[model samples]
Target: MWNPLDSITVRTFLILIGGTMLSGALVFTLAGTERKNLESHLRTHHAAERIEQAIQLLDSAPQASRQAIAQVYANYGLRVDLAPTVGVVGQAPDSEITQELRQQLGSDRPIEIVDQENKDCPAFTGPHPEDKPHCISVFTALKDGTRIKLDVARHDHPPPPFRGNFMRDLITFMAGLAVFAWIVALMTTRPLRQLARAANALGSNLKHPPLAETPGPREVREASIAFNRMQASIQSYIQERTFMLSAIAHDLQTPLTRLRLRLEKVSDPALRTALVADLTVTQSLVREGLDYAHTITTDEPFELVDIDSLTEALCNDAIDAGSEITFDGTSNTTIWGSPLALRRCISNLMDNAVKYGQFAHVSVQKSAGKALISVIDGGEGIPAHDLEKVFQPFHRLEDSRSRESGGTGLGLTIARIIAERHQGRIILKNMGVAELGLVAVLELPLAPSN
Candidate 1:
């Protein structure tokens, strides 16, 4: 049931196992220093005891029985010999092995310590199966005029060079860690990718379905549920507001008509003209208000729309209406959105430009897989402080471009809403050169290519 390829599980297990291994290794290393000291004491103590026993037996036994005694000790893996003391190396090496042997052997029974370079030194054999070239040997003269040699050897051959089982185990651990990391990455990233896709789709499609609760951690499930509820709340609020505005607009229509009929009967031409203008302005505001509400509530199906041709046609329409609206440039691409909504968003911007600048320049370009449509105008650019304020519904700057000049102020607001519904946004900036113009940029995300 174990999947080595599953990245999340593998990573989790490796981190768990690696931390355990590291802790174990650290403890072993720390204890190794103490262990070494105990091992040295035991070695020296054991060797000194064995040599003392050999010395006692040889010294107490008769000359004829010495060989028999040595042979008996040899059976226990210790070699003892009664050899002549000719060319005996005198001084011992200044090391713990020498010092321990001397202290245990005692000053009264001082023995000859074998020098390492002495060619005649005994070829010592140890209890281990492997052979060792280095060891310590002691020599003592017996009371009967014969000398005996005692040898103690330790296993000191370095473990065979590192290319055997060690390399294989190291490679195995690294492979396991890599697999664990891979598995962990896939586990976390897959769910996160799903969340990202859902988030991206939400901006363009309010009716997009809620994210399904997946078989994952509780945190991820909770986050998905929260996102769904938030989306539903926003959609509900928009629908309710739109219904209220539409009802109000429909109710006011009859009253507006009766007022128009009554005003038509007035005989004062100048006064009637002023009243009619005011009434017309009110009617325009109310109509635009209803339109704004509809824009938010309307959920049109997205369709393929050619951006270049759309901008060119809008330019022509403005030109026909006796406006200096020119197509500066265009890109070759198609977008996916409500064609009516996108056209209206761009048209509103163009109308705004001409109303203030007396001219409008439109262009379309693609960058980083997104389409950018810019509406530039030669109007006295908005004050830096009032730029954002102008986007509020029914908000207007009190300059020559005032509300009296026939603007609902919902133009920018509606344009912003449409842009956002297409998963894009709009930004306004003052044009270069004396800041005499304003540039309204609409950025729209392009449809994914199949």
Candidate 2:
């Protein structure tokens, strides 16, 4: 059997997985980008402040203070370089102050110094070669013309390894989503699978007892209730109709019998004979109608039986009656159903073939989830349009209503009712032989328990 879970439609699975993946991607991407941006901002602002403080300390201190300031700069990840001033003797006095002062004031543009009064002034340059090339440089000038230059390099700390970490996190999230998807599939599919099995069983045989009411969400419960009610209604209706038909057939028989007795006393032989013939035909029809009605109410009591045994019995009976009959197919195959009803259905087809076609050939085959029982014959085939009509009660072929043919026109109808009771069907059609013949095909669902 094809399981409902195994055959879950593609649309359902796509909806589940697609929704989860899209939501996860959106949240992960936005949060990861924000975290990276904030870290970048903090590193840049802190680096700028540390570099400025180191430059101020270097300009104000003595040689000892310079060493202390350098230590502080190392701690804060800053680099500083200083150069003293030089000048010609007595022209500008050639003192440290004159040389340093000349260098500090050498630039044409006005230099902004943080502590010009207490420290030697240093002229600002672009930036130190070792620092970031585009950094802003700060210079301080001192009293003795010693210049202190501080290079505040732009902060360019490589971003934390976001790509690699994000990929790992994404993989983990996807893995969790996959597990969650399967879990949801199991929960949702399990109930539907059960319902499918129940439907298949019911289709195969309505007499197999209606499915029990399933407990679950509202939709499933409602469906179960409706199916059960429908099954009960159908069963009750068939039983009621069958009972009414039986009563009618029984009540009509007495009046028909009395009329036949009264016609026997008629003095005119031809009139008496014609009246009796009409009564006989009417009585046969009543009996056949009751038989068809009974078939509708009959429920097959299923039991495992060898299919070959049933076919052999039908064939043997036909042969003993001097009809050419044959059975073909596997002998070991077994199926579940009412043996008497199934045998009768097969026998009825064989009888029709032999009556109209002079011989009967029976065969059985199994495929997929069904069993086929076929009866073939060699005779004039029924017309295409009349094929379905023949299964209706009292219907007869236009040319075959002679007394010798001897049928109440209910044979096919009864057989059909029996097949339907077993959750099977009967079909009649031409076998396409040039010597034209009828082929009756009976299809029955394979019993699951068997």
Candidate 3:
């Protein structure tokens, strides 16, 4: 199973990746649009300049000077075609430019004619026939009365390879951005991983201090502050609970002793017997309470012990007591813990099984750095709802009211506390012929020998 801390770190990394991709995409889109606009403006300006230069050459040339004019147009990487006009009976002008020029010439007085003839000028068009370019066409009557048309077409140049180079550069930039994002995430997440490991250790051992709150970005600093507060709160709560249990146990012992003494003085045999039994029950409860309180207060040094041997001894004692108890499974593994405390926890579980279920069957198993000990029995199982409640101190089942049947009800609670003190856990499950018996499972970490 992945640790909860590792899960948090993975989630944080994914968020960083997602945010970086979104921002990079937006920047790439804006840059591409701006480059296209600038390229289009440059093409338009080049076309306008070509038309102005062609008009100046036409004004200084003769009307029939096709070769000279075509040469000038070709020098500028343009194409030109011209045909002379023949008048009526070779006297009326046949060319489009000559007819338009005659119409302008007949206007009142010799009018200053602005060339206005519209013709398909081939000079401005490119070598590709399909790429029909726009050009300036001018018609004018020269001093000899011969009409001339100047056609100038400019070929549009494709934008240079820089646009493709720019695209490549942008791609490279985005790749670098992605790499930087990963590096940043790795650096930031390192501290978070340390904090998480510390928190997990703290859960298992309250004596350990929290991770230091190092300086970083706002989010990281805030998380560190919150974690520090949580650590202190957990320690405070555990200390308070320990103190409260101790005080309660200490204050109640005197009254319980006095009551037991008074029960011995009753006169009627039957009534006295009943009183004695009640007093005994009260004394047992008080003693169990004191034991639980002590369990929390005593910080006994731990030592390595063979868990199999420990469990076998516990089971053998129950069998000798006339209880139908047996130990099952191999018992050669070793674990580190306070032997006295571990024995108490296992014995409590076995006692509960015998008291409530009539027999106890114990088993021990080792897996994944933990030792699992289970006590199984065949009797009335606990209700699903009340299974958890039975672990609370002083809780008891309504059906098991007899002194011989129901114990002080602190056995399971104490066992759980002991297991937790060793960074372990206890679980209760229903198991029997008809699921009518109880199975108490204790999971304790495997401690290494010192």
The best candidate in terms of lDDT: 1
- Local accuracy of candidate 1 as per-residue lDDT tens digits, 8-63: 54566667567756875788667765677676667667767888778877878888
Runs in model 3 deviating more than 4 A are 1-15, 57-66, 72-77, 81-179, 182-204, 217-241, 251-267, 302-305, 401-406, 447-450
| Candidate 3 per-residue lDDT over residues 1-450, each given as its tens digit | 766545544566667767777876787668667766665454434433443344435546665675687776765645444443521111222244333433544433232222222244453434443254444344444445545444445334444535658788878877787677667767867877878788777765676777677787888888878888988898789778978877887888888788778877888889989887777777777778778877766777888878889999888887888888988886457777889999999999998988888888899988777888999987788889998999898788888635656488788888987888788999999984663499998988776641
The per-residue C-alpha lDDT of model 3 at residue 369 equals 74
lDDT value, candidate 2, whole model: 0.68
Q: Which candidate achieves the best TM-score against the true structure?
A: 3
Clash pairs for candidate 1: 6-183, 7-182, 7-183, 7-184, 8-183, 8-184, 10-180, 11-180
Better of 1 and 2 by lDDT: 1
Compose the digit string of candidate 2's lDDT tens values, residues 125-215: 3233223232333455544555555544443444554566877887887888777777777777776777777677655455657666757
Model 2 spans > 4 angstroms off: 1-10, 45-49, 52-176, 189-211, 258-281, 322-324, 355-358, 365-371, 379-417, 420-429, 445-450
> Of models 2 and 3, which has the larger TM-score?
3
List of clashing residue pairs for candidate 3 = 79-123, 87-90, 87-91, 87-92, 88-91, 88-92, 124-153, 124-154
lDDT of 3 at 12: 62
Clashing pairs in 2: 100-145, 119-142, 119-143, 120-141, 120-142, 120-143, 121-141, 121-142, 122-140, 122-141
RMSD (Cα, Å) for all candidates, in order, is: 7.6, 10.4, 7.9
